[model samples]
Target chain A: MRRLGDRVGMAWAWGSSLCLLLGLGTLLVVLVTRGAPAVGPGLLFGDTAPGDAVLGRAPVFDGIWPALMGTLALVALACLVAVPIGVASGIYLAEIAPRRRRALLDIGVDMLAGVPSVVMGLFGFGLILLMRRTLAPSATTGLWLSALCIALLVLPYLIRTTQTALDALPESLRLVGPGLGFTRWQNLRHVLLPAAGRGILGGVMLAVGRAAEDTAVIMLTGAVWNAGLPAGLGEKFEALSFRIYVLAAEYRDDMQLAQGFACAFALLLLTCGLLASAHLLQRSLERRWKA
Target chain B: MSPTSGRTRGERTAELLLAGAAAVSAAAVLGILVFLAILAAPAWQGAAHVFTWDWRPFHGHYGILPMVVGSLLLALTALLLALPVAIGIAAFAHGLGPRRLARIVLAAVHAMTGIPTIVYAFVSAMLLVPFVREVFVHGSGYSLLSAALVLSVLILPTIVLVVHAHWHSMGKELERTCAALGIPRGRAVLRVLLPLSRRGLLTAAVLGFARALGDTMIALLLSGNAAQVPGSALDGFRTLTAHIALVVATDTQDAAYASIFAAGLILLLVAAAASLTARRLGAGNGRTEAARAAPR
Candidate 1:
């Protein structure tokens, strides 16, 4: 009976694991099968022009150039806001924070990470409404508000990852730096950060991936639908994710809807590529550092 | 000595600046909570009408009871459906499989964590909605049941991974002692392993529940956009996250629009509480491990 039970349990475990893998694998297969046929230079470089009838047949002459540009703009802006603050806070918590405060701060950061994206959108919408009424009602201010909200959304993740990376470093590095007559700042800048830099970049890349896929926040503030291209930071520009949502949900034309799927596939490919490269880069760097 | 003193002064300044930045980041989180509270103040104070069952923002009714009901029900349903499957998988991975097979299984579970939530949402919208609509009940494709099922898939990775980690971390001595007493492997696992890992299991459940609750896109796309308390799993509903997305995304200017902020405040509070609990549980587990590791 004991032998039988062990056999049963093992079978169950393997079955469950395979189920999970299959489910996710099936999703990827479906996405690729449907999206791959539409991938071409025309799809990449063309604009969705009117008069196209069938799905994937429309004169979407321009690929996702504008949406890609907007995504880049949003991600760059978000990183600028989130990274320095997140890295600095991480440094403080790991290196210098008082014990009691560290616990409180850690809890706060965790909570921040767990806040739902829609709530962030709510916060962004509310903040923008206030800003529009009191400050500037222009699109630039809207972009700033949206960027700030996304930064807040990604900040906790960056801080947590950086802190973990910093914590994983050998204590001897700190000792050696200070013993060599280096100041704490010099020790951190020259020794600790460089050692943990790959991990930090990994975290940043993950955060950027997250920021790129965010639809709820951008939908509320940055969605411009057919507003063409953004004129400036204040102009309401649509992101690929938001555009995918809008196209899938609202578009009456099937070709446009297919174009939406193409956009989603493109976004997914972009993010996966970026993340894969970052992971590879980090691994190579770590290997070099070790050697 | 003078050089060391000068270096110390510079270090102190940098530390102060870093500390200040950390403080500001912490404050930014608090500021979001405060801002939500302030924005939702009118609704909470009953100065604004948020109890109406009607969801016509154009007509000035801002009752969010339906959205709240939909969100909670969908999350609960998802939890109920996913818990059994996730635990079953976790148990299998932890105790049932061959060592080589288990490693492969574990890797698959880890990979699931990296898949984006939107991808899951999109797949469900395209695949599950139509299937549910066709096979289960006619004209009922986008019901709460579909949303729950999709959400279950989305959070399955988190649940399975957490429980697996907890199970793997258990001391081998306990198992050996049980085996020496002629206890069957199944009984030993049921009686010893499950009980020891109860806290971790509960934490996993709570986290999964929170993830399901917090999910927006799946519910937005598949929950049929109906602002009603779902009478059955097959009935359509509008979740809080979905409603917030819809209201904010569509509403131009209205006091009724502030109700989205009210809903957000509720979600924030719930998420914060769950996060704090999970963290404490994790810290407690770490301490327990350390205590056990000490020469006992």
Candidate 2:
């Protein structure tokens, strides 16, 4: 009886993970079944256009090409702004900054990272509205505001990972660089950077995943429900997650619902791919740095 | 060389550039605070309409207390339900399972963290809603319960990963000692591992609570958008994040626009508190917290 009870208890321990597996498994199965019908040639190939008003849109269903492009643009713009700052801040925190000042700055970064996505959107709205009211009276929601918000969002993660990567290096490497007659700048550029490249790249990839799929920030910034591809700096744009959201909430009919699912699948696929690569690189960073 | 002694011009310039970039992050946070305060100034000074709980269509009582209470209730429900499951998974994956199985479970939790929040919202909107509606026999499945259910799942992966890491790092020695003394692994785990990592458990729960609190889409899609005082799990209720997301888009006028910022300020306070707690907990302990705090 005692042995049996112990066995049951051990089984219960493992069973804990079963609850999580089941919940996620159910979500995956439901989405696949519901969304699978919506995936086809036009879903990936064609551009998304407005329906109902035209009584006809496109023969190939005019998939989310525009939203896909918009998502790419959002991530690209965010990375372009944040990458340099993030990488630089990472090195500063890891190698150079004063300890007391770094602690205060770290708290600020953590707070920034913790701000909810919608609040970030609110900030972006205020930014554009402020510009509209004062500087550019005709200014509209645009790419720069969303990029800035997302860049802020992604900055903390990048900085953290890069710092971790740099701090993980052996003191011997730092000493060796100096002993070999390289200056501080040269040492960082040559030996230290090459060693930390995988980790920094992993962090960058994770930030890309974050900026690409962020809905709330982009929703209130530049993203539109169904607009033509964004043309200029201040022009409104469409995004995959936002498109899914508006469609899901409004819920016109079954066809629209199907389109929402397809967009979701595409969004999920993109983020998942990016995250998977980041995960592999994170593993490599851990393995290589330790070895 | 020390900072003041042998610093060359090239080194000084490079260091200054790096430090300037770091300053940009700090400035962004301060800028957000100042901007939010400026935008929210009108609401603080405005008419009392924005403070009422009876929200009506197009324009209604803008009182934010109901949404605040609703958000609190939803987060409480999710935390209460998720804590045990997360603890169980973490403990099991760290101790009870074989090495390969442990690796797989941890990987699964990590992958789940990366799933976009909108995908979860979509699933809940489609599947959880009607099921909840049928079970409760109330408003469509868009209820506090549904919101709680999805948010619980959303934060579970984070909590489990955090708690599991804590348990493995801090509790494993005790487990090994108990096993060598002829104790059952389960008893040892319950008695030794669980108690030893109380701080981690608390942090895990706190991080999970914050994530659930800030989540907008699950509540927005599943929680019936009913901006009123919540009655029960079956009743639909609005959350602060959801309310902001819903109203901020359309409320471009005077007090109403400022009211959204006021709502944002409340969220910022809560988020700031969470950040302080995370900072105290040390940087390396809560990887999932950062992941959960960001969008999706």
Give the TM-score of chain A in candidate 1. 0.85
User: What is the model-wide C-alpha lDDT for candidate 2?
Assistant: 0.78
Backbone clash pairs for candidate 2 read: A47-A62, B50-B62, B51-B63, B52-B63
Residue B225 CA displacement from its true place in model 1, Å? 1.1
User: Which candidate has the highest lDDT of all?
Assistant: 2
**Mind giving the per-residue lDDT tens digits that candidate 2 earns over B179-220?**
899877666766677777777887777777878887888888
Error of 1 at B187 (Å): 8.3
Residue B81 of model 1 has an lDDT of 82
Candidate 2 lDDT over residue span A150-252, tens digit each: 8888898888878877877878889998898887778998999898898789889889988887888887787877675655666788788888898888878
What is candidate 2's TM-score against the reference? 0.92
* lDDT, candidates in the order shown: 0.73, 0.78
Model 2 chain A: weakest 10-residue lDDT segment is A52-61
